[model samples]
Target: MTRPVGYYVHHQGAGHWQRAVAVARALETLGRPCTLMGTLAGLDTAAAPGPVLDLPDDRLDAGFDGRDGAAERPECLHYAPLGHPGIRARMGRIAAWAAQHDPALMIVDVSAEVALLARLLSVPSLVVRLSGTRTDRPHLEAFRAASRLLAPFPEALDGGAVPDWVRAKTLYGGFLGTAPATAATDEDGRIVVVFGRGGEGGALGPLVQAAAAVPGRDWHVLGPVSGTGAIPANLHLHGWVAEVRPHLASAALVVGGAGDGLVTAVAALGRRFLCLPEPRAYAEQEAKADALERLGAAIVHRGWPDAPAWPGLVARGLALDPGIVRSLAEPDALARTAAAIEAMCREAG
Candidate 1:
């Protein structure tokens, strides 16, 4: 029997699952049977590259009666609330699945506790790299325990924050997304505003007002606009777009959070972009935006958008180096990464 590869997709948002799916597809192409386990709601395995295992929701793993934050066992991990059945069940499910399947390789995408669990289970594990300030004890412990660390972004985008020892065990796999059919050419002058879930804390109100102020431009808003009570006539609000590639492909300017999905999409399309990073657990979006800004790939606006400053930001975004942005479009990153993982599995088997 062919040994399977397992993936643990974090349920924080769609981005984690999306990345796992891309990698899983690549692994399937490499003739590896893959299984994805996650706590994400409404997970449809029909489109998955291989079998799917649905784990109990970890977010619901809070038994704290009126406690403000999550309950943790100790200083080594985070967010595993005490006496939370969901958390216990989720961890039990993962441990049980690993034991029954005996997967050759386990990929955590990512959680410190899961990576640690994989190592403790005697399974060689790869922990997916995350951006932001990750110097905490839990993060370091997880990274140390993993067999290898896979960073989904290009090596060029690496910020010097990762300790040398951790960097030694890491592999930079460029931006991993479902590669577009063909490289999308630059769009016309239509502007597309994508405010991902993180945008809830952003300046959506000002962004809409700014788009309205900029006349003679078509603006399409994608995803929820948190504070904007009324939709403007000039802007078409699309709650959620199933396939955002075409809109991104034809966009003149793409405004969105610095999440992996939006940034990678814009990079692939070679669109001029302004990154509005929202607060995250470890400054994830902020760090990514900073890197892109340093590369001249994106215009990072740290402050909330105001109508008065909108025009200038747009101008700055336009002036950014298109070549730099386009360089981030790694069409073959997933393929290379999958091939590497397959090789690792083969060696382990």
Candidate 2:
């Protein structure tokens, strides 16, 4: 019997969750039955589209922040070390779930334990990556264990010293965000206040201050919002939009943390953005923002930069005419990635 396919994303950041939704939504469109399996957070992402099997995330964020939060800094990344008996028990339950579900193709996003579960279930599993891979021995072992690896970046960039599995799966143009929505043209040139949903303290407050300093620009926040003071008559608190690409397309500039989804979305839009790499428990975002700056995709603003340089930087980036930053939702991205998976399934059969 052919099993249904599923996408598994570890619930860490919103990026993996976004990809899980996009891919699952596309599979549904293709008349293919697939389940999204992961922690409650990841399952919640797929809820809007279809069904999911909620499992636990080993990378689960506890109260700990990144290295900066500690004295003498034991670890730079905010990782909740697994191996607690609870994690082992959860892993066992997850393996049992996979045995019950028996998905034909398990497309795992950066999760070792999930990949291991797929292996235990005797199901063919594929790996999908966005940014860089883990250099650690365990991470490399996890990537190598997958049947196939896929890097969802344009082939033109970052072709390098990654292992053979990652290189084989690396394909370009996998912009995993919402397709470019029709910009609210009437509100063109407005400032987008991206109300970031981050656990990290000290980031959003300064962004709010810097935005307040700018005059005459319409400000719109994206997620959970709080704070007081005259939210300028021009500044609008748009709590959270269901789809932010339209707003990104319409805005003169977007102000937010260097979120992977936002980075990929804005870069795909080819818009001008000033990234405030939030000081957080983990510097993962800080690292991503730095990479983007080097790619000439965005400016790593120090919360705020000197006023004089802002306009010039925006002009230079915007003038590039990035056009529409298409995503997996587009037929092409789906067709390409799906084709790879389908071929693997057929071969397995």
Candidate 3:
């Protein structure tokens, strides 16, 4: 009998779920049954290749935060709030699922606690590693517990900071997302600005100023934004769109944070990128931006530059080499990731 593989998708960002679906579909093609488990509220799970398990939300109630149970949290754990029924229920559900399925492998999109839990349950887990300085106790322990680590970007972007042991235990799956198709020609010299849901949206004031500064190029803003004042004639706000690929494909240059999803998409599409990395936990985006700039794949800035600086920045972004960015997109990444998981499952059996 072919034992099923279990994937625990993190609910914080769309990237986790996006990668999960892509990987699950690849696994299906390989004849490896897989199940995805996560807090599925507001997510479109219709395209998932296998059964979906919606887990309970483990966040604390309103008015309470992570600091509430900071002292009680174990040295090796990051988030474990006490007296939360949701947390208890969430872990209980995952434990129950493991007991029922006896899964050959558990793939954790990212959660130190959950990876540790799988280890406790005697299920070998493969953890999806994210970029950043993740050398803390909880992260190190989780990496050690994992049977293997999966880095979704090319190995060159790692910056060679991780310990020798982690590098040895990892499988570098370069950019696991939808491969880019031939992009439409950008006759209008459009500049597309994107903001992801994982963090605060872009500020409209700076965007307006930028658009006004660069009068020749039209700026199309996607996703949410804060602040409202005068709207620039050249700055068109579309808010959140159902699809961003069309806008991205027709853009002369792209501006956004250094998130895994946006970066992967830009790389795959061979678009020029102006990375304004937003602040994130463990300085994830900052670290990624550093690697991108170092590799000549993007033009990075610390923060939103003044209106006077926008013209030069825009020119620099447009001048970047699309071929360098496209090189980071491994066309066979999804297949390689799925094959690695299958091999690990076979070894376990």
TM-score of 1: 0.93
Per-residue lDDT tens digits of candidate 3, residues 194-219?
98877678888888889999999889
Clashes of each: 0, 13, 0
Candidate 1 error regions (>4 Å): 60-72, 181-183, 198-207, 226-232
Segments of candidate 3 deviating more than 4 angstroms: 62-68, 181-187
lDDT on C-alpha atoms for all candidate structures: 0.81, 0.60, 0.88
**Which has the better lDDT: candidate 1, or candidate 2?**
1
lDDT of 2 by residue, 150-256 (tens): 66554533424466656764454365555555543433777675644443322345445545566555667677665555554655666656677777777777667
- Displacement of the residue 149 alpha carbon in candidate 2, Å: 1.5
Looking at model 1, the pairs that clash are: none
Error of 2 at 199 (Å): 5.2
Better candidate by TM-score, 1 or 2: 1
Please provide the root mean square deviation of candidate 3 (C-alpha atoms, Å).
Answer: 1.7
Using lDDT as the measure, the top candidate is 3
TM-score winner between 2 and 3, please give it: 3
The lDDT, on a scale of 0 to 1, for candidate 3 is 0.88
Model 2, C-alpha of 184: deviation from truth (Å): 7.1
